[model samples]
Target: MPLSGDLTGDGRISPMRSTAVGIRSTRNPRLEVPLGPFRPPGLSLTRGRAGFGSLVLIGALALSMSPAIPATTVRDQEVAGVATTGGEDPGIVGDSGGYATAVAQAHPHPNPIGRTDPGGVAARAVVPAVVPVVFGPRTDETTLRRVRTIRGQIRPKSVVASGAGLVIADNMMYRHSVTIYDTSGALIRTVKDRVTLAALGWPDFPTPVSGAPVEAAMSPDGATAYVTNYSMYGKGFARPGWDLATPKDRVDDSFVYRIDLASGTITGAARVGAVPKFIAASPDGRWIIVANWASWDLSVVDVATFREVRRIPVGPEPRGIAFLPDSRAAYVTTQYHDARRGYPAELYRLDVGDWTLEPIRTDLGHFPRHIVLDADGRYLYASMTGDVTVIKLDTTTGKIVASVRTGAAPRTIALSDDGLSLYVVNYDDDTLVKVGTADMRVLQRLATGHHPVGVTFEPSTRTVWVACYSGTLMLFHEEG
Candidate 1:
């Protein structure tokens, strides 16, 4: 059959041919033939009839059958062919089965990504990969907390009984002395120089010497006072009881005299280390420990025999000695030195039971002048050249937990009876500071004279005593 619709050789279709193709299928033709536009060159009729009469006869027959064709029938048939073929909707043919299967197979629960699928079958969630964080296990806090909670159990509320006395060493005009004040801040008696000189076997000197009483110690019962006399010889054969030097008149030996507290009489005298800076008795009052500033050794004396026992070798410029509560250990503080030369000063813990000394591994900065321990023994407080260091000591582990800073040039520290407060003597500022043990907070500051050096608290009197280098002792109490 001829192609339907506009099949003419020219661009335009005649109205007659358009109508013929539109109605060709509805009509009847005398012969089976083609209709619409004529074929192009090199075409022939299906039935070979070579004349125009035959061509006209075929045209008439196609016109008679034109009613059988419908308008735009060829376009409809082309669309139907494409639909039945695979060309149209290729994506649907490729993915439809797999997509349907996936939708049917999804879980009906929450997914690991914390999300839900479109049909609410699964939730999307994320599971983290495993990772471990390791740390050094420490029990310092538990130990400190336990110590603080039990501090008051063994500490005494106050000193019930107290004894007072004094020891004096003579100077040129005025006798330098220290009076042991009772809890009431009252001087019990005056200890003067004549008694001290007589006790030291220095009988008669026409000219008075320019020396003073440097330090003193009292017996446990307060019955006797031992005073150290600092004296120097200037000219001629040195007087009795004073060492005569070769050229510079430096006294080779110093005297420690014992005095009767009640009678004010000299009882005993012995030569001790030169420039004795401090004197302390053993816990049982059987031995006396003295730190000689000019010497690099400590002198130990048998209290009963009044004789030297042993001189323990220590660091350079050792100044302070503190015996542990059990009396088994004594801690000494030394002046700072160049560690490169093996002279670095440190805090030495001396095993009194064996006389063995070991340096405490701690960072005390430089110039640890004095050292003290807290009531519970959890901490060591050291007064260095410029600050006070509160070292949290682990006695079992032998490590330091923390080192806290304090005022400038702290010389000494005295812990209160309650163990909650610490009083520091700042030599540079001449001030006494009360610090809280728990939080390391400064509670109070009391001004004093120039160069406050030593600090001690008398529990019976509830007063804090400060030894001023400016020639006076200051007493501080709550100003109510």
Candidate 2:
């Protein structure tokens, strides 16, 4: 079915019309897709066995008439179950192999403070025209090299740099919900996600509910940390959130826990949209923005009140978010590919002041998962799972200046404090790649544990931390 109208901000499916492309959904609860008006072309829906046979015939006919769809059409299916294999030696790339670099022309009205007019003239008219560029790596010197690996029952989905000179591994419903490590890779403590919602302001009923931690963000002072729960596993949560679920599913809402870093205690909790994934705190420490994967929107939480202030609809499967240095704007990645547009995905720029969004068009391939900003906030580095490459964009001009192929299924990315290097993990390849930001060159690559899904750069120790889904953590240190 083709998605027809706008989402209603609440976790409900929008109007959809059946007709066009065929989409096979996964059985994984965490990998649900949003329901839209995507209609399979030339296929008719029926309730009986005869209708099923007719549907198959129509699908086969449509496939024969059209070009084969790329394997990336189904998110993560390409590498989800693939074996972790690697034989490449760590080395630096010298050039992009003559691949083209896409550059987006600057819009006439480049004012950053502009709002989305009611007519959407600012949103539509100011859309930059992006020139297609060949996706590959540019060159730089190697600095970060593999140091060691820490293995155990830690099934981490993401690793974050807590401001207090610590690294946090978010273990989603694993043995431990979160694991804390010092910059030197020493285990500090493990915190469970079980909390009393009534104590945190939800007074309807009191019960000890456990949360499946997915991602986390630290406050400016590092005194506090906010972690997103993939799902709640106790009372008050009836319908679980799915990774590939539509709004119509009306999945149970999740919560973000505010933790006191010193005591490692969940001090507060705020309800948010379903399946909240990537999260970030504004530079000025005024607000916390969460990218709700299933809800296709953002929950803005006020730091002072520790409550969700507003929920704004972005697009389907909003995954990554990066705020500007001044806390005036944020960049979000809606990684869901739209079959109707026949394009990969979209990136949006949110006006923090007014809660308005402007879609930034790009040729970056499907599933742009993780994004990070440079120290100066002038350039943005994004990891594209579909393209298996990382592209750098000039924030002021909105141009794809450079790109480099890392490996298959590059997930989380981290930028060096000095803004000279970038670290990315290749989930399918089971490798960590260090790239020089100056030219988007591959500085070095190293074999990691199975399914290295998350990476973070620790400045205090100048070391790189990686979280592997195979219950291991890899650490890389800078020799320079």
Candidate 3:
């Protein structure tokens, strides 16, 4: 196997110290054609220098006497040294006598040693009179070397870092209280909910909605943290929310509790929409895009004003929202619910400038949930319930060039700092797959907690953070 070498950020090949050599032989000299078509009369060359000296003296006299036999070719009888290896081409070169014999006897066959090349028995015994060691200072030595390290601390199933510190949503309690931990997962403050639906404005509610905050996303300036409350208001006898006495009262409106990070207190709460699942920010950090799964609408909120700017109607069950850089447009995914209904889902291009919504392309696959764009803003990736699809989007034309498959049930995706590979969370398989963006191949798979949902890469930490549906947060380190 070819050992892996550390490459630069630009993907340049940097040669490392190797111990293996690759060899190839040149064509034999016996097959060479004679210098001339015929030999000249009275002209003879000897095998060695001693024989050649006497022959050269005789040949000079014969050349004067023999006018009929034209001198076909002149042979140089001096033994010359030839470099059979090393230098530019690492091939044969003719030079002086003793060196030529030594090189010819030592290297009778082809031998080429690279940095990794293993020195043979003859090469070990014979040393060059003037050994040349080529050395150059490492290019870009100022740049820090990236090394992969194992995460010393085991991540919880789900971590929501809010104003109240880090909260771990654990399934151990079943319809439970949030586990409040410090930055290091040590228990800090646990807040249990005793208030009913009426306290939060809703009245005549039968089954009270429990608090299960799955993921928490902070505002760009780090002032507010929006904690997504993923709770169902029903019992186990039927499907979730099916046993409700009143349908409207039974509907669970997921809340995004806006907590002031600096104050460590809940400042306000916004009723975004039903199943207000994942949250994303606009390029300018002026708007927050929330994906409402049940309503199939993207709720755009103006950050400064803290009000609903516009509700862009998308496809069925929009789960992921990604804003394109340098533009007022955003892309949201409509996850497929039923294949028989031909609801293969699409990416809705929401124009924030005009508050208009249009379907960009609908041909990706079933249940396209999570979406992310490349740093160059050329390609857009949608992770579906079946397979992740890479759609080459022409930003000007608003059209898709091609769509390629990625991984099984890809829920969330994040790009590396260098943008060479994409990290995807496979929710169903509970694994994270690293995919190469250039060739779109699965590079590596990492075991993660159950039902990983939100995926984000932190450049400063060089760690991939994953939020899980099973109430866990996983931190994966990049492999060198």
**Candidate 1 structure lDDT:** 0.42
User: 1 or 3, which is superior by lDDT?
Assistant: 3
Give the poorly placed runs of model 3, Cα more than 4 Å off: 1-210, 231-250, 336-345, 388-394, 397-406
Best of the candidates, lDDT: 2
Across residues 265-325, which tens digit of lDDT does each residue of candidate 1 receive?
A: 5566555665555565544456667765545557776666565677775645556676655
- By lDDT: ranked, best first: 2, 3, 1
Sum up the clashes in candidate 2.
Answer: 32
Q: What do the candidate models score in CA lDDT, each in turn?
A: 0.42, 0.62, 0.43
> Model 1 segments beyond 4 Å from truth?
1-174, 194-211, 230-251, 337-345, 376-378, 387-398, 478-480
Q: Is candidate 1 or candidate 3 better by TM-score?
A: 1
Worst 10 residues of 3 by lDDT: 40-49
